[model samples]
Target: MPYINVRLTRKDITTEQKAQIVREITATMQSVLGKRPESVHVVIDEIDPENWGYAGELTSVHRKRQG
Candidate 1:
């Protein structure tokens, strides 16, 4: 079995987008790693911007600055 974990900042992501992500990742593993789709597991964890940091600052702060 192949397991993949994806982490993203909580934002305006939609259900369709998340489904596409899981499908693509599953397909890649199936083709490249010879894993069965049924045996593959993909997990997505969405974190609040305030909980995610980069460049010594919170992601929320970074996005605000970008805007």
Candidate 2:
């Protein structure tokens, strides 16, 4: 079984977009590794910007500075 994890900061992501992501990932596994679509697992994790950090600062803080 192939497992995929997608992580992103909390934002306006639609259900349709998530589904499309899952579909494409599964297809890629099938094409590249010969893994069955049914055996591929995709998990999406949405984290609050405040909890995600980069460049020595939180993403939420970074966005506010950009604005």
Candidate 3:
């Protein structure tokens, strides 16, 4: 069995995008780890902008810095 935990900041990403990500990740795990799709569990966590940070800045601020 494969268990995946995905954490991301809440932004403008769509549900379809998230689903696609999950599918692709699961497929990759299935091929590499030889795990079945049904045995894989994917957990996506949408974090708050204030909670997720990088480079001593919150996600909202970090994104602007990158851009």
For every model shown, what is its TM-score relative to the native structure? 0.95, 0.96, 0.81
Clashing pairs in 3: none
TM-score preference between candidates 1 and 3, better one: 1
Q: How would you order the candidates by TM-score, starting with the best?
A: 2, 1, 3
Residue 1 CA error for candidate 1 (Å)?
Answer: 2.0
For model 2, the local distance difference test gives 0.95
Deviation (Å) of 50 in candidate 2: 0.4
lDDT by residue (5-64, candidate 2, tens digit) is 999998999999999999999999999999989999999999999999999999999999
Q: Compared to the true structure, candidate 2 yields what TM-score?
A: 0.96
Better model by TM-score: candidate 2 vs candidate 3: 2
User: Which residue ranges in model 1 land beyond 4 Å of their true spot?
Assistant: none
Q: For model 1, what is the alpha-carbon lDDT of residue 30?
A: 87
Instruction: Evaluate residue 53 in candidate 1 and report its C-alpha lDDT on the 0 to 100 scale.
Output: 91
Please count the clashing residue pairs in each candidate, in the order shown: 0, 0, 0
User: After best superposition, candidate 1 residue 48: deviation in angstroms?
Assistant: 0.3
Model 3 alpha-carbon drift over 4 Å, by segment:
63-67
For candidate 1, give the lDDT of residue 15.
Answer: 98
